[model samples]
Target: MKLHNISFNNLRRRKTKMAFLTIGLVVGIATIVTLVTLTNSMSSDIGRKMDEFGANILITPQQNGLSMNYGGISLGGVNFDQKEIRESDLALISTIRNSRNISAVAPKVVGAVEVDRHQVLLVGVQFDKELKLKQWWNVFGKAPERGDELLLGSEAARVLNVMSGDTIDIKGEKFKVSGILDQTGSQDDSLIFSQLPVAQRLLHKEGRLSFVEVAALCSGCPIGDMVLQIAEKLPAAKVSAIQQVVEGRLKTLDQFRRFSYAMAGVVVFIGSLIVFVTMMGSVNERTTEIGVFRAIGFRKSHIMRIILLEAAVVGVLAGVLGYAAGMGGAKLALPMMAEGKQVQLVWDGVVAAGSLGLSVVLALLGSLYPALHASKLDPTEALRAL
Candidate 1:
């Protein structure tokens, strides 16, 4: 009979012991796969949602300012003219190398306007892009879609004594209050939002942008590189990244990935230990059988191969069954782990292949010492056990 046939027959004879070993390996592999899959899915979902929270790149006109100090005393100095970023220059942002990472670009034109004799800051924005960038905005009414419609902040509406559906005059033009934003604890809570063209016309700064907000925090986006590229494209504009926001989100995702890996390591160690202990026990029980084979002219290599073959078979079975169980567990556990977010499980062929290979390699390593011990047994000494 061939060496593999002997290994197969031995496994069939020791069903109970082999089953225990298989179960241990399967459980470990399944736990690992489940943790890794869940972490990846949750990180992706959270990253996408966080990316939509706000803009990570800020584009503003670069201005020159002078500071005057005399005799250790500070004094206000003359300021140079503030350069305006042309609205037409925004298209250059799309020409950057990492432009594909850019999600939303909100161009804003800010100026002061008078309403009911009260000075209010008027921020011009493209409603479509603005609304998309600020998904967290809770408006009391609908967003403005027309030049004659206006969205008011909480403080702006309160100070102006206006609500949704109220008409207000700005610079002698009548604008309907389409919505009042909830108090956001930011400057936005005291400003009025209007259509880009209308505000530009009222502010007399046509085709000029005060600043731009770009959302570009996608998976693996190089934020620093993107800032430099955008700055290179718009030389007159100062482009900078909001480091705190990007860093916070990245740190959270990194923690998730690291946690999964750490847990997987622990499981892998335990799985290997189980395989080692079980294989050692099996080898000890078959010492007399090993002696019989040695006396029949079986080589040490053959004996070793037979022992390893058994482990290889068990590892293969464990890998397949483990992967199936892991995916099922991940699907069931996703809802609770994702903070109620519904995340879909992805069947990655590469992960499946890796898990299979990992199981086999671990099995071989765990059984290596036991196999060696079995091969080195003396025929006479082992036969005494018979």
Candidate 2:
């Protein structure tokens, strides 16, 4: 009979012990897989949601003003001509080194316009990018479609005494109110929104933007690096990143990842220890059998192979069961853990294969010392136990 067959028959005779060893390793592998899968899914979900909370980087016109005391009276020094960014030049942002980290770039043309002869801030925006950037804005009605259509901020609508579906005049041209925004308690609350091209034409500042808002945060890229890169690309525009939201999310994720690593480490250690103890016991029980094989001319390497082969078989079984259990655990645990947010699990085939391989390797390492001790047994002493 082949050595492998002998190993297989030995395992068949020791079902109870094999089952215990497989169970211990499976539990460990399952916990590890669950933690890793959950961490990966959480990172993606958090990153996407954080990206939606609006632009962390503000690109606005660089102000050039001087303040000084003149003739015993404090008077501000004359300011240079107002600088505006050209809409055409916005594409240069995509050439930055960390440009891929930028999620959205929403340009705006800020100008003062009259609504029923009362002056208010007029903000022109590309609805596609603006809508994505300001996802927190809850509009009661639809976003503007036509050039003549516009959305009113909550405070603006209140001040103008108008609601959605009302008509108002901007820059001597009639505009239909398509939507009214919910109260946001920000400067946006007092601003009126219109399509970029239409507002530019109305304000007579075609292709000139007051500022741009950029959303830039991803898995592990530094926001500061992105800001520097944007500044390099657009030297004339002031680029600054707002860190409140991004920093908070990053801090939370970091803590979560650390906890996962700690727990996984503890579980893996316990699993390896269990495998070692079980293999050691198996070696002791088979002492007389080993002695008989040695007397019958079995080589030390052959004895070692039989012990390792048994461990490898158990490892294979544990790995398969562990993966299945981990996936199931993640699916069940995520809802409770994440507070009802839907988390789509991203399958990592590499991790799955690695877990399988790791299980086999762990089994081999755990059984090695026991197998070696069995190989060095004195036949005369071992046969006495028989």
Candidate 3:
């Protein structure tokens, strides 16, 4: 009999066993697919959040008395005098030789202000410069044109029960609401933006900026090193990068990714064992059939090929079905997993092909040992057991 015919007949005869083995493999493949998908999605999500923050490098006054301990040892905090960046420092940055990607620079002076019963963050920003930051802000009216005009974040607008053309009292000074930025689910969505001079005046801060938001021209540049270089040049002002903060969070997430990978490995290992045992059991139950094949002059090599072919067919079929099911499962579960955060899954053809390829390889590995054992069976011993 042809190897193909023998394999097909064996699979049909042991339908229940094949079905169980396939289910085990499908579970493992689905798990692996979900983890990989989530890992990629999270990386993209973190990058998007960083982009919304606008500034690649953030400059802030170093906080006092922060310390850390390692190996049961404590290290004292490095203290530096608090100094604000001047307009001269901004100009100096513009002149740096390798700072070509320094696109837009804006200084922010943040403070607290009371509007009726509401306490809000008062942000003094350069209106013209902030436009180059990003597309985070969509003004409902016009951008701030003068000291009297202010833009509120969407949440802030809803809280204050005010909109465009309305005036809100901040620290007893009335300012016209010129615009309201669309919500981006960040710190910006809770603050008020006004001309820097206006904010400084309202907050009683003169010629002093709390921090400078510097938008870099290059997206994938090494921002931490750039921040360090900037800090070295402007010894008076401290520098912080948005990428640094995002990377710190990503490090923590890396631990979770490792855990997910380990879990997937465990699940796949168990699934492979189940497939091996199931195939072995099917071989034992079909000993009489094997004897009949040997009687019909089937070569040992042909029997081996039949067993392996059955395994390969089962593996491929399960892999395709598992991939389809995994994709569908991810689509349905992504939003729920994100906990109301806006997320997007970008499907790459390469990733999909790789995932399916991995599934096939795993399936074949799972069936190899069982297929070998079945191929080595003695027809005389198999018939005697039957």
Highest-scoring model, lDDT: 1
Once model 1 is optimally superposed onto the true structure by TM-score, how far is the C-alpha of residue 68 displaced, in angstroms? 5.0
Residue 65's lDDT within candidate 2 is: 86
Runs with alpha carbons beyond 4 Å of true place in candidate 3 = 54-56, 60-105, 108-138, 144-210, 215-223, 241-252, 292-298, 346-351, 380-386
Would you list the rank order by TM-score, best first? 2, 1, 3
Cα-based TM-score, every candidate? 0.83, 0.87, 0.68
lDDT of 1 by residue, 1-386 (tens): 89999999999999999999999989988998898888777777767666766898999999989999999899988779778799999999999999999999999999998899999999999999998899889999999989999999999999999999999999789999999999889899999999999999999999999999999877778989999999999999999898685577568768978988998999999999999999999999999999999999999999999999999999999999999999899999889877555566767787799778888888998999999999999999998887
Instruction: Give each prediction's root-mean-square deviation over alpha carbons.
Output: 3.6, 3.2, 7.6
Score residue 342 of candidate 2 by CA lDDT.
67
Looking at model 1, how many pairs of residues clash? 0
- Candidates in order have lDDT scores of 0.91, 0.87, 0.77
Best prediction by TM-score: 2
Q: Which parts of model 1 have CA positions greater than 4 angstroms off? A: 1-16, 23-27, 68-77, 255-270, 293-306, 320-349, 372-381
Task: Give the candidates in order of lDDT, highest first.
Answer: 1, 2, 3
* Tens digit per residue, CA lDDT, model 3, 1-386: 56798789878987888898888878877777777777667667766665555777787765555577889898756655556666556676765555876767888899999887989999998888888686567778889898999999988999998999999987778899998888878888899998898888888787888888887735355676677778877888778766656566677668768977898889778877877788778777777877777767877777777777887788787777777777777777778755345888756566577666766676667667766776677878777865
Clashing pairs in 1: none
